[model samples]
Target: MGGSLVGRIAAVALTIGSMVCARIALAEDPCLKQVFGRYCLGGEVDPLLQSVPAPAVSQAAADSLALIFPDGENQLYVLAFSRRIYKVVRAYGVSTQLRFDDTYRLLREKYGPGEDRSQFPEYASTPAARLAAIRRGEGRAVHQWMPSPTWHIELSWTRELGISLSYVANALSASRAARIESGL
Candidate 1:
């Protein structure tokens, strides 16, 4: 009877130790508390909007909104249901005098090298796959960073779209992100 009790206690201790190790691993994320400009991951949109200067309507979807900065350097997108900042897109344009290189340099300086930097031209078979691809920053070219399990930053360069930076929420379902991205 005493041997069985000791075994159960040992099992419980091992489980607790495993949980602690998992938490430590999660806490080690380099950019877990990092922010982009004035915004951070998982932040509410309304307050951020209120704090910043008014933005131009770059695009308005049925359930999402993309607001461009006055300087035309960046775009902010917010998801409807949660009203959270879902994506921050930076557009490179000669007229706006924006350069993707500067942004790339800044990101590297801030977060160091990303976890994955690759591109896959093949289209995904399903919406889920598409979202996964997007999350992985898989496209014509991709530079991706996962600051935390809940947030990701993807920098993609394509012939059609030029170079753009996207900060996405990983916790949200791929379907939901697809819907928001597509404005469906």
Candidate 2:
């Protein structure tokens, strides 16, 4: 009878310890901080934007909306669906190789080295040649980081859009993909 009581006590302690550990892990997750400045995934847009000045332009679509704010030469785009922010993007007008490298280093330091998913032709072996190809719209430079299952970060450069850093909510993206796959 005493042994049964002791076993029950031990099991309760183990369960409580597991719950505490899980909560701590979630609080320390870096991806939680990777969302838009003060805004978070699945959070409402109005409350989050209250502290910031009004966006320079706003566009709405069938299911999503975008708010564009000017930041010097760059543009910050906040995209949302159902009034909840799902993605944030900062686009730099001057897309130089140096700028791309600097941004890449900063992101690497914070999130560890991301996957370099740049696509270049066989002849574009050197860094300079790759940059030239990208400028000519023949290739694209992409670096991606999946810090957690719920968040994704990508830094990409293209001739049409220049250099942009994007943060995406994976759950929202998966839902969009599902709709596309189902042709709905």
Candidate 3:
């Protein structure tokens, strides 16, 4: 009888411990609800565009909504659904080259060197050529980093387009994400 009671107690203790651990893990999911100033990647989408700030201009597509904020020439673009964010792009406008440099410096300081760097050369012979190359999607550079197992960040730049940042969530499976994203 004593042995049976001890076994039952151990089982109960284990169940309680497991429940506690599960709660902790769920509470600390690294897929940040907010990564940038106030934007979250891969979570419930904001109801209003003004949830952050009124965009200078906005566009919508079948799968996404884009907002452009021209404040400070930091032309920020955000793509989100009514459920989650899929992509974000922030342009530097006129200060494309300078912003690109500053963004690289900041990323290095914050997250160390990126895991992968894909940089295209600027082969343009003239200023117009460089601009043309950038417009043609040439001379584009991207540095990617995995800040956490669930979150990935990409810093992209082009001579003519300036700098931008992107964040993605990789923790959820496609089917599961689709369900959550669809509010099902």
Candidate 4:
């Protein structure tokens, strides 16, 4: 009986240790690790970002960003100018009912008041618009995919403080030749 109890405790401790390590690793964004609570500089993510601090985006504005995404197959991209973790691009067959803030606010409202920050040690307060995830592009070429709603949301950031976000949909077929560049 004594041996069995000891083994169980050991297993629980190992499990807890593993979970902590995984959490830290996931939280370990290169841009954030070096800065350590500093504001982020807008630019291609680099080693020097550690010295800068982060800024705050109001919940309303953050929520509103989601609205810009069009309905009925659209593309949406979020280029995090000041924060790299917030940057992402997703394009998919969007439903007409698709709206941005609906999903985000629910996460916030659930937390209630006086919630401890440590419980959600994540630096970015932004809520996912629609099951968001980090995606790698194919080589140097801008990556493309159909996550839902939009067709394409090309995203890139500068070393300064600018993130380019664009929404595109209902374009020519994929095999068709479509090549052009425009500025804002």
Candidate 5:
């Protein structure tokens, strides 16, 4: 009887220990504050490496969102999380204005200063959309966007219950993002 009690105690101890560890791991999850390129809180992004493959995302933070400017300028920024390359979420001719205060307001509206409540998993998303946007590369996530002349893209990912919510922000540069600003 004593042995059984000891065994039960051990099991309880272990269970408590495990629960603590899980909390610690979850606490480390990245959020919008960690917004940038590929960020992994628990696992890692496994590059297909079919071709040379963009360098093996050396560090989770190093993984980038490659933006091929309409000007034919291609820049890789640590703003993309990938199992593959990422694409700027765009709707052809929807040219977003680049205003600082307005951009901040948008962010405040979409996500407040803490864990967001509305970031639920999107189920109706098509397979391609899921494959394209969901967290990949060892649970790493990236936020993608394209600045419309006079703006630079910004991104964010915040966590709740160990999941990440990736989002984008368009803060304009002093110049324009496109010559035409309206086209496919």
Candidate 6:
């Protein structure tokens, strides 16, 4: 009976330790600290719009609004649903392999190497070749990092979209989608 009691106490201690460790690991995830300019995921949209220069265009949908700002050689899109910002994207017009590589390196350095979801044909061996393939609609490059269950960041390049980095709040996005689906 004494040995069994000791073993039970050890098991409880182990469980508590694992819970604490899991919390610590979550707290240390750098992706949770991701932000777009001065805007953060799940932040109010009005404040962010006011802080930035007036957008070049604004479009309103049923449950969401999109603000597009032309910033230098890039375009910034802020998408808000139910007055809260859920997604932000920065699109680069001048897409180049070097530019994409530099951005990829910076993101990897900050958030660790994200899951590379790029689809390249076996024939596309070199970086330039891959870029050419992307331009020709033969392939696309995408890397994504999900820091937590609630948010993710994606960096992608394609012929039509060029190069873009997106920050998304998953929970809010899901809520928006549900609302749209139900015609609410």
Top-scoring candidate (TM-score): 2
**Ordered list by TM-score, greatest first:** 2, 6, 3, 1, 5, 4
Off by over 4 Å in 6: 1-34, 48-52, 120-129, 179-184
Candidate 4 lDDT, tens digit per residue, 30-112?
32211113322122333322322221221223211211223245433333322232333333343121332332234235433
Per-residue alpha-carbon lDDT of model 5 for 69-101, expressed as tens digits? 221222223233433222232211221223323
Q: Which stretches of candidate 2 lie over 4 Å from their true place?
A: 1-36, 48-52, 180-183
Q: For candidate 2, lDDT tens digit of each residue in 17-108?
A: 99999988766432343454555665556654554677888888766778888878999887877676778888997888899899999999
Superposed on all Cα atoms, model 2 deviates from the true structure by an RMSD in Å of: 6.4
Worst 10-residue stretch by lDDT in candidate 2?
28-37
Best by lDDT: 6
TM-scores of all candidate predictions against the true structure: 0.52, 0.74, 0.61, 0.24, 0.27, 0.71
Better candidate number, 1 or 2, judged by lDDT: 2
What lDDT tens digits, residue by residue, belong to model 6 across residues 59-125?
8887798988887989988888887778889999888878888999998998899899999889998
In the range 1-184, model 3's lDDT, one tens digit per residue, is: 9999999999999999999999887665333647656666665445446565677777875645677766575666666654456555666656555666788789889999986575445566665565566667775667888877766788876655556677766543354468568876
Error of 6 at 152 (Å): 1.4
Candidate models: Cα lDDT each = 0.59, 0.80, 0.66, 0.32, 0.34, 0.84
Model 4 ranges with Cα > 4 A deviation: 28-44, 47-80, 83-152, 155-184
Weakest 10 consecutive residues of candidate 6 by summed lDDT: 28-37
What is the Cα-based lDDT of residue 54 in candidate 5?
48
Q: Give the Cα error of residue 133 in candidate 3, in Å.
A: 4.3
Whole-model lDDT, candidate 4?
0.32
Score candidate 6 by lDDT: 0.84
Count of steric clashes across candidates, in order = 0, 0, 1, 26, 20, 0
Question: What's the candidate order when arranged by decreasing lDDT?
Answer: 6, 2, 3, 1, 5, 4
